[model samples]
Target chain A: MKKILNSADTFVRDTMEGIEAAYGDRVGLLDGDFRVLVSRYPAPEGKVGIVTAGGSGHLPLFLGYVGQGMLDGCAVGEVFASPAAEKMADMIRACDRGAGVLCLYGNYNGDVFNFRMACEDVEFDDIETRQLLGRDDVASSPKDRADKRRGVAGLVYAFKIAGAAAERMMTLDEVTAVTARALDNIRTMGVALSPCIVPKVGQPTFTIEEGQIEIGMGIHGEAGIEVRPMMTADEIARLILETIEADMPLNAGDEVSVMINGLGGTPLEEQLIVYRSVHARLAERGVAVVMPHVGEFATSMEMAGLSVSVFKLDAELKELLRAPAATPFYTNANK
Target chain B: MKKILNSADTFVRDTMEGIEAAYGDRVGLLDGDFRVLVSRYPAPEGKVGIVTAGGSGHLPLFLGYVGQGMLDGCAVGEVFASPAAEKMADMIRACDRGAGVLCLYGNYNGDVFNFRMACEDVEFDDIETRQLLGRDDVASSPKDRADKRRGVAGLVYAFKIAGAAAERMMTLDEVTAVTARALDNIRTMGVALSPCIVPKVGQPTFTIEEGQIEIGMGIHGEAGIEVRPMMTADEIARLILETIEADMPLNAGDEVSVMINGLGGTPLEEQLIVYRSVHARLAERGVAVVMPHVGEFATSMEMAGLSVSVFKLDAELKELLRAPAATPFYTNANK
Candidate 1:
């Protein structure tokens, strides 16, 4: 493999150490575990603790979200491997304030099982906990089976809404409700031009022939809906938008937030090209984009692909999205 | 070539269109010119106009930095090709708000020539302008000949200082002085594990054998100091830091800002691993790291490599670095 890593065995630990060292003033490891990263910024008294956890390959995702006005902590696993329940429990314990804790993560099977176990573990200590699964990938399931879909870049929307709600001193139930609402409003679909390699595997997780593309692939090289000849930027944007709009049924005068996310290897220039197409199509449909984000929100290590996410917003959701946030990898307008 | 693009010929314009579509509220293309991007946030009367420009492919560098308290405007060229002098002149005319304009870019021949021409073009209009060339790549020159080196990620520091100085309403000469100081204090070096494919060329910029690295490689695949066997993370970190310290003659109690920038393809997980080593090594040398930024500040498409930039900071530089800035890609603590 042509990766610049010491060894697969130490990759995760080394990355965690680097994160702590680089952002020492803002983030640190949880007391007993280096895999659980917690914010150095104190959790406000009686504020709901917001925690997100998942595999390590997707940076600026779970751990990178831990900071003021965002996640309180995150449990990180090895590349593409879900963290153990113990690690999640540690994160929950460390992030918990008087108001209780809420856990948010993608809807992968391993993540679901581990987080469920962690919730039970934390509950044994009388720390009330709630869980919300983000399954916003419209291509993964039919509109009627949205719960079966997997989450992708749309998880950022959930993070924003839940973080803002917690920052507003919302109770655990209120935070959970708003987080679910954000998750429900989000829809994502991706097209992959190439596959990503897992360090431990020392090979690509999947393969694609040159000049072909995989539509609806997951962040970790999961199977997509179809593989076809490569399409132009405009064609790809239309396909993904039609699929999402079919599920969400966006209409004229609808206001929503748009995210054109790069899967590791895709450059921001290409992502912006995709965003331009998206914006044009949305305008044609008379849908107004309220807030637009174009960059690598979540990624598969060096995978050349991009995902488009649309979060239909309401007044409440728009306010939450607009709230100030500060993190090492992400900072919104927080003046 | 496996790329998510429409065609090489239209890539630059398409990307620009996408940027405008996504960030229409915060940025817009200069009137009568699509290559020059100016911020929607109006320049205050009598405030120095800060502008930076360079070839394309480095997203969030020239164009992404144009927003509040960062850059007033930027001239973008085709991938790895400098924008025409006419575009730069147009940007200068538009950004100038009666307090003159300050031009900052890397120490590249084409950039230097075009910007010089632009200054002359606007001279007829009586708009005073000052230029600062960022030549901080230590490996590109000996310590005594630092001015001969090329610029890399260190240019970002120059932008921050000049942007903040202008935001504080510094005169054209004062902003130019601080920017020059920032450029002088900055040093950078990079290693490339693999080559990146230029969209127009449809081929890798250069090639390297598997398990090998090119140390001190340029952002556009220019020749590096040496080619060596791939080393462990600690070994690589030591080599880079030692080289930088040797050039700067760093000593105990020295304070610096560190930036571990990923060349597009390197994942954040791996970047953080490198950052961990950088932090530890700097600590071992008794050098204090003031503000640490660990992410993809500058990139060469999806090149699988990284660069380290160290900026020795004074009190004035530190305050400017800490000053609030907001852009689509970056936002600093403002409150």
Candidate 2:
């Protein structure tokens, strides 16, 4: 329950100010908005300007992804809420290179609505744009079609491919094509072990029984599809992999990259335990894991569950994933 | 206190097995030790092998850092303990290139003894080796002579510069030079808000009052110098920065890379607040922050608190840092 803030309302703004202060020389804030652009006004001409925006609270996800290789800019909103339309517009305008901008974001209603609105606003300023809403959360949809599901940690992988393509000065259409490919290959599902308390609300976002878990909770504390008794690490991993496989329809001999992300409260040891179960289950099915990342890649505030994400990798996607990436949240250094 | 493990003694081995199972195609365990090497073994013949080893619990550190553009290999031991001399020797042998091998690690009695033993073993085998003991924790030493302090988060900067140099095919001596420069310029101080639990002990690593903090804590839950009542965000930032400034002898207008790393249990929002205080203080002094990262870099299980590290960037060090890096624990994508 402890926090360091003057008040809940100022948390997002103050935090953004800090981010700007830290990287101000390389990044700049749009006047009077949540938009942040990599400094120097516009990126090199002909490059597809990469922009990702979403609600705050997921550091490195919505904003921390902005830098040399990942996002060109990010529009941040208040905690768990979409940024205002004007903010998204300003962010796009700042990063636009005349080749056009690609609006990459999660598939939450508020984010979609605002980002779509911003698309119109930027178009009015004579800048062309394309919107690609990520729908990669397999747990939220049935087996036949997961594109209708929500998007969660899968955005990180998509960002990697899209960012790499954009950095190569790929056309907007090319960038979009690669991003969609990466998105289609990505599937994610998260469980909630404990609820997160919004700073403004000062209460639990959701509730679960002691020693129990919610199998398909959304990032904003939305209810899950099912509530299940507490299970062992292996059991949880099986349920998650089973659900994701059903939705994504991965078959034997598929090459995949796996991520077991902690939802804040879990320790690295415990996450590794989850990964152990996940890897064993995948091995039994003959799938080859090309890359495995075990840590807190994305997190909800103090939530204890872990989310599993699998990205079926192709030659191009594997190369992009192997491409170097550095951000505040993730480092490739041998520290 | 709940954990998913057959027993405490089995944790490290089990975890390594799981990592190999998941990433065996990309990474492999050294022939007979806990050291993990990026698959393809022995890197290029002339490529300097950057080897880092320490205790197991700090994931992404010893293991996560061993990948492309970073470490060639890492040796791991039980939780909070150094690898055995033979294991360290085996790790050096597995990773050594004709150029030489560099033994970079933390400064602790167990680590120093075992690493020295490793150096001797490697020399007996005719593989030249050098040691770069990281001692960047400023709180343990006064401003006049901080070289005696133990290493903390600052070791990350050293690793990055060294790893990047090695990736560029620098000779072992050259890599060692860059690493020494990084170590000289780097400084870190950590504060603990809560303590981690060691599985073997099945208890908290240290204790603190609900609202108190321990400044200058060692990574293994060792006691800190000051046990002050909790203060505002600004106060904590000032304390950390002042200690760093005094210890590093950094003057105004110095360009530095800063990292505010969470111990484990602290949330990102809290870390951002700490970042706010940190940036504001540095900005007031006109210090140029070249690179700023805020997140869980080097953790102590689920212990809460954060460490602040500043590395005064010089031309070569900055270039190496800007080099592309990609690992399981971090990434700095190529521009």
Candidate 3:
């Protein structure tokens, strides 16, 4: 991988420092560790503070969403590694506006364990807190245990809903309920054509033959369900949609929002090609697509592949999706 | 040079069809000639309909910025190739409201020539039109004629100012003046570690030896003024800043907005590292950064490099920069 850098170990911390310097006036870090970047002002009195924690590398994903109309604070983990429970607890305390705090993140094993423990510890401090886990990657689990799927790009949508609800001074339980609802309707599936390089390892996380693609690959380079010869755009789109439909069981008439995300190296043009095929097949299946976003919404550092995320939007989900929330990454037309 | 596709010629047109299919209900396209895309519903009646055009390949750069709070319409040329003058004239007429139309684009030679002809044709059609060029690439011209530099990512800023002013019901001339002012304040420089394959050619745009980079390279794979061995993030940041400073001459205590945009293949993590170095250098130089947008604002297919853009902000430019605008590519808090 060609890049401009000093060392892999310093990637996350240095990036966070730059983020602070650029937006520090609007945000602040925890007393010691800067990983727990938060708004300069804590949540208002009696408001539910929202804290999201996950491994770094996904920009505008966690920290980008931490701002006025979005997250109150976020705990940064190491690159694709979960932050410690103690640090997570501190972030919750710093942003807990009197009402309570909600800790939200993608459903990864290490993340799940650490954040849950942090919630309990924060509660022991007499600070009310709850955990909202996003399990939206249909490719990670079969139909019977779809809830066991990994969380992928759909976490962004959950952040939006939860962040907006919290910004409106919603109660902790309400924020959790809204975010859970958002996750319930969100389903994502990803394929990797190339592997991303871990800074420490200084090598690829996964590998494939020149023209091969692995569908249902995890972000941390976890093994995918199957490997197949590279397929046409139409074939790949069909494979992703078929898996998502079987896992989530979306009906023929369901209306959904589509996200055609690039895994870094795949150009936007290629993503749009996949989007065209996906849209055609969805139309053939009599599904209605609303508010589709075709771009690099979430990426895997220089990996060449694409993911398709479908969010089955109801009145509430659609309204939340349309609501204006400002994050460095995501934006909406309605405020 | 790896891509999954049948051919390159059909790429952009097919992608446009898909973009329309996703958002086409609200978007309209010119029937066959220019491939110009415009907004649907209540086309502006008495306002200056802003028309911007350029080659394809820069996903959100020239076209993605078109929508309600942004451009009225866009005419897309072939991939990395400028559109014909007659085609631009046709699109300008389709988008022209009774007030007049404004032609906005980069300052590349081909773009300048075609856009000038389009402007003349529109004037002959008894419709008033003005041309505003974005010449922000500092490395393209000598210090004395930085105004002749090719437009890079700074075009986004010009588009923002023009779109906001037009939305506020400004006259065509007023919009032109503000856009020119914003463009004048903007300066950009880029580096290239590798090159992207032109779809038809199926080869890299340029070749670089291992462990080497081209500083001040153009977005379309044009050669840089300085060719140096690959350096650390600090060294690269310094090279880019020095080039921009030498060209635009930003002084200490100047307030500017920074955009660290990845060319294509560079990861967001690496981009942030570059940002870290850039922030430190700017702070050391006593410059106050107003807004720092760090991501892929403009890209060259799958090249591994980034560009730094600094737009010196006045009160009006800052207000416009902060104003709410929503397009496929960008969105602010209020949108």
Candidate 4:
């Protein structure tokens, strides 16, 4: 593999060690447990604690989001493998203050199952917690089975909005309610130009014909929902937006935040190019984009693709999304 | 080439369109001249106007820094090709606010020649202007010939320090003095794992064996000063830090801001892994790291490698580096 790493066995641990070394003032491991990361600045007592956990490889997602005005703690897993339930329980306990903790994570079989077990364990300790699943990717399932869909880049909006709500000292139930609302309003779809090699696998996850593009491919390179000849940036933007609008029914005067998230290998230049078409298409439909995020907010390790997430916002959601966020990997001006 | 673009001829234009569409609030083109990007909130009458220009393909480099507290304007060129002197002159005239303008750009042959001509053209218009070149690539030249060295990732520090000075309403001479001090204290080196395909070229810039790497490779795949078998991330970090220290002489009590910038295709996970070693080595030497930036701050489109920039700072540079700055691609919390 043409990757800059020491060994496949220690890829995840090495990454965590590096993360702590770089952002020690803002984030650190929980009691020297490298798998559990918590913010260095703890929230006030009675403030709801937000926690997210998932497999590694997706930086700025489960792990990079833990800091001031964002997630309180994150239980990190190995590459594409869920963390242990005990680790998740430990993270929850660390982030828990007088207010209850919220288990906010992506909706995946491994993650959901482990988090369910974690909540059960934490329940025995009498730490109140609420579970909120991020189900925003429209390609994994039909709208009728939305709850079964997998989460992708849209998970960023969940962390952002929910973290902002918790930072504002909302109750656990209130934070969960708003986060669920965000999940319900968010939709994300990805187009993969190339496959990525997992550290452990040491080979391409999948192969496709050269110059072909796969729409709605999972981050892990699972079979795409639609594979076709490579389309122009405008065409790709249209296909993704139409699919989302059909499911969410965005209309004139609708205000939303748009994120063009590079998976891993794509450059910010291309993400902005895609965002141009996305913004133009939305402008044509009279939909206003408030906060435009274009970069690698979430990524699969060295995967060449980009995902677009549209989170339709109301007044309250808009305010929360605009609230200042200061994480090691992300920071906002609070404008 | 496997790129999400409309046409190769319009690659730069397409990127500009996308950037302006997404960040119109923070940056825009001058009049109908798309090559000249100026900040939306122009500098006040007496504030020094900071303008940077260079060939494209480096996101957040010459273009992304044009905004409040960073750059007043930038004249953009094609991918790896310098912009015309007329466009540079136009950018200078547009940013001039009675108080002089400072032209801050990299030290490249085509750019130096072009900016020299640009200043001459503006001199006739009676618009006061001064020029400062960023030269920090230790690999490009020896300390005895540092003036001939090429500028690379260390250019980011120049912009950050210079932009902060201009925003504080420093005079042209004052801004020039502080920026020159920053340039003298900076050093950079890069290691390339793979090459990137220029959109118009439709081919990789260069190639290497499957398990080989090139140290000190330029962003456009220029011949490296050193090539060897692939090394672990720790080894790579040591090689780079050793080279930079040889040139800059970092001391035990020195305080520096480190930037491990990914060249498009390197994932943040690997970047952090490298940072882990970089931080450990610095700590061992008793050199303090402040405001570490680890990401794709500057990139070659889809190039799989990274560059390390260490800018030793004093009290003044440290405050300026930490000052609040907001651009489309960057922002600081003003902490």
True contacts kept of each: 0.71, 0.38, 0.57, 0.68
In order of appearance, the predictions have TM-scores of 0.98, 0.86, 0.93, 0.98
Model 4 error, position A159 (Å) = 0.9
Instruction: For candidate 3, write residues A1-335 as lDDT tens digits.
Output: 56778777788888777777766776767784767888764457987888888888666567777876678888878778888888888888888878898888888888889888888888777998888788888878886886687788888778877877877777888888988888888888988888877777777766788778888888777778999888777788888898888766777788888888887888887887888888988888888888787776666778888889988878877777776665555566521
- Give each prediction's DockQ, rounded to 2 decimals: 0.64, 0.31, 0.54, 0.68
| Every model: iRMSD | 2.3, 3.7, 2.6, 1.8
By lDDT, rank the candidates, best first: 4, 1, 3, 2
Best by DockQ: 4
lDDT tens per residue, model 1, B1-335:
87777789889888888888878778889873669899988778999999988999987677888988889899988888899999999999999999999999998999999999999999999999998888988888788887788888999888888989999999999999888888878889999888888887889867989878999999999989999988877787889988988887777888999998899998998888888898888898899998788888889988989999999988999999999888777676622
Lowest lDDT 10-residue stretch of candidate 2 chain B: B33-42
lDDT of the candidates, in the order given: 0.88, 0.77, 0.80, 0.88
Worst 10 residues of 3 chain A by lDDT: A326-335
lDDT of 2 by residue, B1-335 (tens): 44444467777877787666655655778774444444343367888888888887776566767777777778887889887888878878877778888888888889899989889988988998989988988877676765567777778777789888988888888889889988989888888877777778888855888768788898888788889877766788888888777656666777888888887777777787778887777777887777677777788877777888888998888899888776656666412
CA displacement after TM-score superposition, residue B7 of candidate 1 (Å): 2.2
Residue A306, candidate 1: alpha-carbon lDDT = 93
Give one digit per residue, the lDDT tens place, for model 2 in A109-173. 89898988999988788998988878877777775665567878888888878878887888999
lDDT of 3 by residue, B1-335 (tens): 35655457788877787777777766657774337888663555777788888888888777777776678888878888888888788888888888788888888888889988888888878889888888888888887876667889988888888888887788988989998899888889888888888888877756988778898899898887888888889888898888778766777878898899988889887888888898889989889888788877888988889998989988998898888776666666521
Off by over 4 Å in 4: none
Writing each residue's lDDT as its tens digit, candidate 4 over B54-132 gives 8888997879888888888999888888999999999999898888888988889899999999999999999888888
- Which predicted model would earn the best TM-score? 4
